[model samples]
Target: MTDDDDLRTRLHRADPAADVPPTAPDRVSRLLEKTMTTTTAAPRRTTALRPTRLITLAAAAVVLIAALGTWFVLRPDNTPGAPVAAPTVTEITAPGIAAKCAEPTADRLTEAADLAFAGTVTTIDGRIVTLEVTNVFRGAPTDVVRVAQTGDISETMMGSGKFEVGRDYLVASSEGSMLTCGYSGEASSPGLAGLYDTAF
Candidate 1:
């Protein structure tokens, strides 16, 4: 047989039941058509997400603005309000005593140091008398006096009658120094310096 005939026989024998029919020109045409279709068709489109992205950004910006506004409104003022009133320094005096007695007995008695108070005489032993002055502006007894005299100073100076307990006395002394009051003798008792320094 000829060479061409022999090659065709071998190809036919390799796949005799195969459905693919050999046609060089037809196969070339089909491949060209497929290439044209692919090239001419539009490209797959990516979804447009700009609108959704813009909305999310706008929401975040609104939240930030709201937070800033709230903070500004709630901020405290640096300058405060008016000052408060100080406690009244009311010096209680003896009933019926003239207001002029508020002054110091003498210039040698130092400045008006007697802290006017209203309270009862706590104790009165011979030569030593303790007055428990209360309702004091500053808490606790502000003054304690040790009166040094020849006779009962409470009755002598206060009056000829007896100095009863709970009877209030508006006392003036040499600088509100605490000493045994209503006594008359040469006994020296330590004066009360700062009685209300800590008691208050």
Candidate 2:
């Protein structure tokens, strides 16, 4: 052989493949499998809601349902056969009125009248009868209001008697000013007064 070839064979060489651990190929395969499993499971972990978060979502849904139910059931309306409106309670501590009339009910005088009160007739002139307002049930009124009770003013004013001056009466007006049949009647009984305390 050539002298150069012999020199090449004498040179130093390293067996890198021999130094590797025997388990290294198997270990690398196991690590690669673990990495792929972890990566696949990450999508499920991020997408799923935790138990506490699920509970919070359920509670919010329940509260929303309750609130919606309340609003739907208690809405206001004025149609006939509709539920009698809930009474608007005001300070009844105002002076009680003593009037001479009879039989006025909350139901008979449906939800039409805007104002109701027990008052004493101060004067009777033409068709107008001035009254001293004693109680305010559904509206804001001054101490005195003028009303017209024609034909038999006493029929709705109080009892069967004529609307004599200085007599007390119960008046309910739907048109705010003009008094008409049925609703405009004499209210005299203390018990009836209490029952008719609500406006339709």
Candidate 3:
């Protein structure tokens, strides 16, 4: 026999399925179909999961967007408003009488003066003078005091002898009337503080 025929014979003897009967075409076709269905089925299922994962991600994104929108709409405002307080005012009217005065004594001040304080003049509108109370020497605490300047200031008052805006004064009052004749005057008046200290 030729070398090619000899090699074919050797290969055929060594083949593991050489003695097996040949498969029929119809059976082979069924096996091929089954194999195609089994191998391709796993890939089809895997491809379907991609769309499902995409849909899940889309749903999560929508929920996150909705939550953020709600927070923005319902957020609390932090704007500031006015915080200044209105001052409490105490009104006292000074007597307009120009009377013959006697020497002001601490004994008289203690007996007659019911309210005494140190204050700064804030405004003067016609015969009305407004003072912002600084320190209360006697009586209830007050933020402001208004006095009606009905007459000339006593010559005994220190500084200008009259109420002037932005200047501090020591004042004493009884029954809603300002005391004059050295009993109330500028804060820097000599002996005035000593008199107040002795009186109250």
Candidate 4:
């Protein structure tokens, strides 16, 4: 016998279902037709779901876009009135030299001074002196005041004759210039409060 014939004989002898009968041709054809129908139906079902999924996603996108548009239209500006502006800064310069001061009179203070207030010195930085106004004596109301010191201390001012932090002062100014000839002095200086009271 040939080698191929010998191999076929061995396979047949070793086959577990060698005695089982073959399936009928009609039954095999029916099984093949059922399998093809199921496979084709699966693809149709998948294709039908694609449109539904796309429509759902599109509807969600539309809702999101509408919500964002509404929020943009209705958002609060949070500004009630005029927008806030920067703090008003009143600038004044200290006298550089001492001058002969006439006796401080209430009438002179009232006539010459356009601004006067009682304030406590809050800081003395470099050549700048900042004071927090505690009371308004003869001028427009202000919360804070800054004075530019010119290194030279005027003996005309009371108590150390210069601006010092934590000391209360009664200050008078004429046209943005600080008056130093006893018109402006420490609050506790003799007759200073009385002078302001009489002037205002």
How many residue pairs clash (N, CA or C atoms closer than 3 angstroms) in each of the candidate models, in the order given?
10, 3, 0, 0
Model 3 stretches with alpha carbons more than 4 Å out: 1-85, 154-156
Residues 23-67 of candidate 3 have per-residue lDDT tens digits of 999999999866753332211212212333334333333342344
1 or 3, which is superior by lDDT? Answer: 3
Per-residue alpha-carbon lDDT of model 1 for 1-200, expressed as tens digits? 68999998899889857877677998889997666433322111110112232233233333423343342233221212311132122222222222232311323223333443333343456644444332332222343333333343332233223333333333343233321232111111111112212112
**How many pairs of residues collide in model 1?**
10
TM-scores of the candidates are 0.26, 0.39, 0.55, 0.55
lDDT of 4 by residue, 1-200 (tens): 68999999999899999878999999999998666433322112122123333333334333423343342233221222311232234667776656677888999999999988765566678989886554555555554679987647567786568887656677898887788777887766677767777887
Q: Best to worst by TM-score, what's the order?
A: 3, 4, 2, 1
101-163 per-residue lDDT for model 2 (tens digits) = 345556756565566665445556776666544344455543456764434443333354455
Least lDDT summed over 10 consecutive residues: which range in candidate 2? 40-49
**How many angstroms is residue 171 displaced in model 3 relative to the true structure, after the best TM-score fit?**
0.4
Q: Local distance difference test, per candidate?
A: 0.32, 0.44, 0.65, 0.63
- Model 3 clash pairs are none
Better of 2 and 3 by TM-score: 3
Model 1: residue 86 alpha-carbon error in angstroms: 26
